[model samples]
Target: MSGLSVLSGGFIAGLFAAVTAAWVAVGRTVGRRPRPTTAAVFLMAILLTIAAAADVVNAYFSYLPRLGDVVGAATEGGSDPHLKTADLRLSTTSATLRAHPRGAVLALPVPDRGSGFGATTALVYLPPQYFDRPQWKFPVLYLIHGSPGIPADWLRGGQAADAGARVAATGHPVIIVMPRMSHGWLDDPECVDGVGERVETHLLRDVIPTAESTLRVDSGWTNRGIAGMSAGGYCALNLGLRNRSVFGSIIDMSGLTRPTHAGGLGPLFGAGPQAQAAMIANSPDLYIGGLGPGPRPRIWLDVGRHDRTVAVAIYHMRDFLDANGYPVQLHVRSGVHTFTVWRPALREALSWFADDVARVSAA
Candidate 1:
């Protein structure tokens, strides 16, 4: 849990305990022939009631809002909140285009760079201004999607196109590229050139080159920023850290810093200890830790407090970075592993990337 959430929980528990103690004390004083069993039952009932009340409050304020924010931020960030009526547009190919108040869509093709996965698809979001002013090419923010999923996950899960438009409206004017990785899981392919499958080669050589060529994008590494959720987050960190020549900044939203130690990774990569060693060597923490305090990308790591699954891993990453003297911005918020937490984290991450992008573009 975050410091605030932990404090809030402790405060509520203490308050309940104090009230219960007072009530028990009062009841004991008033009852001249109090039965021990009756007193015990009354105390238990009071405790249960207090616990239930705390749980309800926690769920409402913390959990519910987190979920709603994922949807609300994506839908509401770049639009007029006061407008109740808006037209929903439809795509030419019968894909439902949800209404957005501040952005336009661009479908870009991912080239076949000999990875055998031919011509992947990527969706780019251009701010509303791009339509009015055609000569401007914005710095690109390449967003990667998670595993057991495709590029569509960011659109469907985070509604990222709408979010990017909203963010772009605030003067960032970024082109958000959602690219599909060849491997279909949330773990990194180590970004190694020819290991199992050259996923990194496909990304850097094919996807990025195609994006830069087709889109009005800034070409230098300093103008590029990468971020992702879950598996996408893993890819972002892996690619950004190892290929520092390409990405200027990296953001990991609930991604694993180290490979899974539970033997799942070996089977996932279809290799044994040696392959796992290579993956670990390419991990962000190891590479970033070894850097000699020169020009490295800005790093942002965030996790939800109640996310029991990845919280520990995230904490280890944060600690490792700190101990290794790597510069990182860490945010631990109150929530679980759901999109509720990730969406807000993503918004904040984009804001950071936008700032970095602006600085680089202006230079």
Candidate 2:
């Protein structure tokens, strides 16, 4: 039952049936009992019913695939501190990946050198080609995970390692790095350099340099790409476009057009005229309109058909980029804002990026 998929319709139906039956049985058993006892039983049943309803919402969204994910999240303390790390020497390979033909994920402790934002451990997916072609320096793709998630969510939920391996099998492998966006699991900094967290500065000054220095990936601007889903998707577009000299490709999967927080922007941007200006500056769609003449990064926009507001934003961005003579690709699929759309989107975007990098390298 722990391994059962939460997204399965049959499973969801069965869950609802079981919960309803249990609630009904509890009510009947406690009927005509003492007032306090009956009331307690009713309260417990209501709480259980609410939990079942929450599970239905989770099933619809496919936040976590398996019931074990909840247990794992609790048991593992919401972090992968003990995940195996690859040898710093890029030429070597661990016995784990040596036996299998898959890429390996390494935990990297990126330091907060310049940006005051707290840094968490980053995950790097080294393709099979990295060990095979020891002399070759591969392009790097920075994958930003969604909020309410950790770096390991990219591996478990996004299936990023498998996606990177699939792209590697195509003979155009790239180094993929999934970095932590904030200090904790629920921190929603929006990947911006405002308030106490200088996330943008951290990515540019700390994460990028850390990867380049420690990994066997090319540090060239054209060889680097950034991608993310949900809020992280917005970060990829905003960060990649703003730092064209560092990143040459951008992929946004069901992302918003600007920085947002469920608790409002006051904590991150403050309350003043400067706050309004800061918010405007971070809005990708707003600033991209005034983009000056310079190196233009390839843009990939993908959103679900049922994503309504996000879909509209993505379509508008596609049209704007197309009309402005920028290289942009749009992919709209049938789904909502969930991993069902993002996993495939990441795979396709990475393939596209690999092809673009190959063409550039060949040229």
TM-score of each: 0.67, 0.81
Give one digit per residue, the lDDT tens place, for model 2 in 1-363: 011245455666876676577666766786743466666676677656655665666544444433556465432212233222453334333333442366667767788877876666688888877767677899999999777556666776577877787888899998888888888655788999888689999998889888888778887877999999998899998998888878899999999888878789998899899999899888978887788788889999999999899999999888887776679989999888888788889889999999999999999
Candidate 2: worst 10 consecutive residues by lDDT? Answer: 75-84
Please give, for residues 1-363, the per-residue lDDT of candidate 1 as tens digits: 121121244756786677667676867798764477876677677766665665455343232222233344433222334212222222312123333457655566676877665677676765655555566766788887765345655654466665676577688877788776744433344344434567777888888888787666877777788887766677787778777778888888887775442335564355777766676666766666676655577789888888767778777777876776657788999986656777788777887788777876677
* Off by more than 4 A, model 2: 1-99
lDDT of 2: 0.77
> In candidate 2, which residue pairs clash?
none
Q: At residue 80, give the lDDT of candidate 1.
A: 34
List candidate 1 stretches off by more than 4 Å.
Answer: 1-101, 183-195, 260-263, 267-276, 291-294, 323-325
Best-fitting candidate, measured by lDDT?
Answer: 2
